[model samples]
Target: MPDRNSALRGQRIHGQFGNISKEPGVTFREIKDFSYLEITLWDWARDSLRSKLAELLGIGDLPDTGDSQRLKEGRLLHLADGSLAYLGAAAPADILEVAITPEEGCVVPLGHARCLLRLEGPKAVALLRRGIREDLRDTAFAVGQVMTTDIGGIGVLLLRPDTAKFDLLVPRSHAIEVWRWLTRRAAPFGYEVL
Candidate 1:
């Protein structure tokens, strides 16, 4: 097994750093304790791969392009490029060893390559609106949805698993930049770097 390290290890200062707008309306922290597995299914192998995944992972159908499926351990996000990301407790080794064939699909471990950040609080939607130009209204983006977009030019996989949270999966290299940008902008709303 590879060593586990945090993308925002030294960058995340555990405390409120921004303006105390109505009692800290936002809080963020790196998600380091989950497995982020990526499965890229070739066009012709989609059905077989989905079946194999269902049989091996004991999970139901993957979400549609703009949605997410919550599981017991974590959640499954359907990426824009026809890839499936399972951000769960651990990689499903059985699926890798038995289900995945070259013809079926390929697995990529994104645990370390990406930085998962949990952003939540009352002002989460409001703060995200400052950078993400998406209609985040519950009626539009609704809970259990995911989208790929950019914040300050950094590509991110934004997942709304709950009504109050927006989990951002960012490239490892640019996690801190986002942290800084978010904290600075969250000042008015009051934020915590927990």
Candidate 2:
């Protein structure tokens, strides 16, 4: 197992609302309590891995390769089918552990640096609009668009993985400040962290 102390670099604080802060600099405010099995293939064997992952996940046809291709949420899909396989969210954790191991050039619990914030309520978009410079308009940024931008003067990787939901990934050191700022902005919109 990885070092528990290293895994949790920040402190968790629970607010009056459902918001449960996992760390002072990081929080796991469940946007969608999703469980996903991710399989990353070495660069050399991406093609073979894609085919294998498709077969394993039972997705007869994978999305075409290009900027236009995207996976649907809640569906067994491949994130980067040619290089990375994602079995969708809400998968059994135990099964995920079994499918991946040290061998097969697979890395379980892919070390992706990420932080999620659950933005709900009617005015969610308005709140985000105040902080983010990017045009949050639907016409400019549709759902599932993985965007790397800045929010509240801090660099952030934003993703609208699903409608009415937004995920923000900031540097680990800035997680706490960003979370607090986000919550304050959401006040007008009636935001709930979890």
Name the candidate that leads on lDDT. Answer: 1
**How big is the positional error of residue 15 in model 1, measured in Å on the Cα after superposition?**
1.4
lDDT of each residue in 3-98, candidate 2, tens digit only: 222212343344433332432222236332443344566667656655765565456555442112233434332344433433234343344456
Model 2 lDDT, full chain set:
0.50
**TM per prediction:** 0.90, 0.56
Report lDDT (Cα) of residue 156, candidate 2: 70
- lDDT (Cα atoms) of all candidates against the true structure: 0.81, 0.50
Number of colliding residue pairs in model 2: 3
Clashing pairs in 1: 19-187
